[model samples]
Structures are given as structure tokens and as C-alpha cells.
Target: MAANKAKRPLPSAQPMRHNPNPQQILRPQYGLRISPAGSQPQRSRLHARETAQLMPVKAHVYRTIAELNGGFEKVIQDLQTLRQISFFRNDRVTAMHDLICRVRAQANRDFTMTLHGRELANAGHFDGLCIEWEKQIEDRSDT
Candidate 1:
């Protein structure tokens, strides 16, 4: 005999709960391959030396240039602040102070790089010409 206890209902299993894989919502080309999506991706097993060899040194130089540019901005900020509360003995001294401040303030640019950046600037123009020529010949049959 039960001692005034209310019995809890057992959860009913749905048909879908037993199915191992869910349905693919998208078509083949638009979505991931089934096995790969369900499994862990293959990882590179490179050592530290190998990884460094594979890394782009140019990209690191670019990043360092960016960091240096940021540091230049902080220095410029300090120089500007110093100018606002500067003391000078003579007109020449004050003029020197102003010149120093101006140079420091001018140093804050978006980036500094080993590259002149001229080739990079012309790169887009070259790409555009290439694309235009390709389009012109894209529809033509080979001779």
C-alpha cells in the first residue's frame, strides 16, 4: 500500500529522440559535409621551429609598425600636454618648445612601415585593369 505519496510520471520517448542524426536543413553544396561537421577537424602537428618557419615575417613587421605608431601617439599626447603648460626663458626658447611639440604631434600617423606603400596603393589599380581585361576576353573563344 502507498503511504499518501503522489507518483511522478515517467518521460515518454519521442520517435526523433532515438534517431542518431538530425535532418539536414540545407542542400549539399550550400552546407558542410556530414562527417566533417560531426567530427573534430584535423590539426597541424608542427613544432615551434616549424610554426615559426611557416609564419609570415612580413605580417609581424607590419604589426610591429602598427604598435610603434600607437606608441608615437602616446608620446605626441604627452608633448601636447607639456606645451599647454610650458615655461620658457625667452622667445627663442618658447619657439623651440613649439617646434618640438609640433614635430611630436605630427608623428601620430595610422601606421609606419618598411614599405613605401606606393606599390600597395597602385595594386588596386593594377587589379582593376586585370579584371577589366579578363572580362573582355572571358567571353571570347581561344584562337
Candidate 2:
């Protein structure tokens, strides 16, 4: 014969405390504290400055010289447009110009490293064009 076991009673659940000011709840996951009603939260000047700067659009590496040339043309047009806009800062414009120069340099470097003999010789014209484009971008950024 098996002996019977006695069960213990479950403990009662405690009620959650209600918060009077719901807006002041701490949210650790978001890394932002909700300010109390009527008072504004302080923001850093760096954050405001960054928000004003124009972010560059994503660009892909072009495999062909034609594509690279087209990309450069598009960037130049964009820089020109940015200059005309009253809101864009000059430093931001210079940063964009520097980005374009870097892209051109990378393309040229890749072409030189990947090709040799006749292929390299054939791209001599393109090398000269790249130099001219770099000069143009620098001149535009300076003004």
C-alpha cells in the first residue's frame, strides 16, 4: 500500500504599485530618460550639429570605367546643387568633395592593381581624366 502526501496552499499575489507620474518612467533599454511634465530635456550641441549636416547617400563600386565616369558626373552635380542650397554648411560640402576624391583614388588604384600590359596602357586616357576630375572637385570645394 502507498502513503498519501499533503499539498501546501499557494501564496497570494501582491498588487503592483501604481505610478502617479507615468511620463517619468525609467526606460533603460532606449538609453533615454523621459523628462517630467512641463520641463524640457537638455540636448548636446554636437547632436544638433550632426543633425544639420547632410549625410551622403550610399555608393557602390563601379567595375567599368564608363560607370565610374557617370558616378563622378552625378556626384559633381550633387555638390553643385548642395552649394546652391542655403541650409547646407561649407564644411559638409568639403567633406562630400573629399569623399568623391577618395572614391576616384580607390577606383584608379584598383584598375592599376588588377590590370597589366596592354590593358593598363589602354586605360592611360582614363588616368588623365581622373586627374582632371579630382582637380575640378577640389576647385569647386574651395569656392
Candidate 3:
């Protein structure tokens, strides 16, 4: 029994089959390198304080009719672009309508000021543009 046992090979003694070229071999040549901590630049407190102290600026207020009319042209272009994008269409349209109403109010105020003897350059042009924008808003609302 001792002689037979000695001739028998152990199960764990089988040779391992290795590929000549492994597909997922770890190549140490392409490994990442760790940089020294002293190589990084330091941030200054002055820059941080400067950024923190900055105040939020408000939107430009249109004082004259011509300026408001020019702004209206830009708003029309923006509204056209917004309409092309279908996502959140109703909300954007409502916001644009509100903006148009605010512009019309400003135009009315300018007209009132003109009645009080204040001269406004390009008042006729501005009035025409306001009328055109009102018609556009009406057309859009009808749909």
C-alpha cells in the first residue's frame, strides 16, 4: 500500500497552462507616476477676498425710446430662437410676454414724458416697432 501511494501523483501537482501572450497583462511601463507635493502652486487669500467682495450688477435700464426699441429688436430675435427650441416652450413664451409688457409700459411712460414737453429722438420709429411687437404677441396668443 505504501509503494502504490508513493507512485500516485498529488492532485495539486498538475502543471499550470500559461498563454505565450496574455491579453490582460499588467504593463508596469504604462503605470501612473506620483508627483511631489511641493510641485503644486499655492493659492493666495487676496484673490479669494477680491472674488468674494464682488457685488451682483443689475440689468441695464433703458432711459430713452430709441434704446428701448433697439432692445426690443434683440428681444424679438431671442424670442424667435426660444420658439425654435420645444423644451419648456410655454414657460419661455410666458416670460417673453411679460418682458414685452414691461417694454410697452416703458414706451407708454416715454410717450407721457413727450406730452410733458420732453423731446424723444426716434419716437415715431419706436412707436411703430411697439405696434408690430403687439401684433406679433396677439398672433402668437391666438394659436
TM-score of each: 0.29, 0.35, 0.29
Ranking by lDDT: 2, 3, 1
lDDT of 3 by residue, 1-143 (tens): 13322223223323467874553342222322334666644335654443344332212222344455656666766676677777857676868867886877787787667543322334444565589799999999999
**Top of the candidates by lDDT:** 2
Q: Identify the candidate with maximal TM-score.
A: 2
Whichever of 2 and 3 has more lDDT, that candidate is 2
Residue pairs with colliding backbones in model 2 are none
As a TM-score, model 3 comes out at: 0.29
Instruction: Output the lDDT of residue 44, model 3.
Output: 56
Sorting all predicted structures by TM-score, with the top scorer first, yields 2, 3, 1
Q: For model 3, what is the alpha-carbon lDDT of residue 112?
A: 63
Error of 3 at 36 (Å): 85
Q: How accurate is candidate 3 locally (lDDT)?
A: 0.54
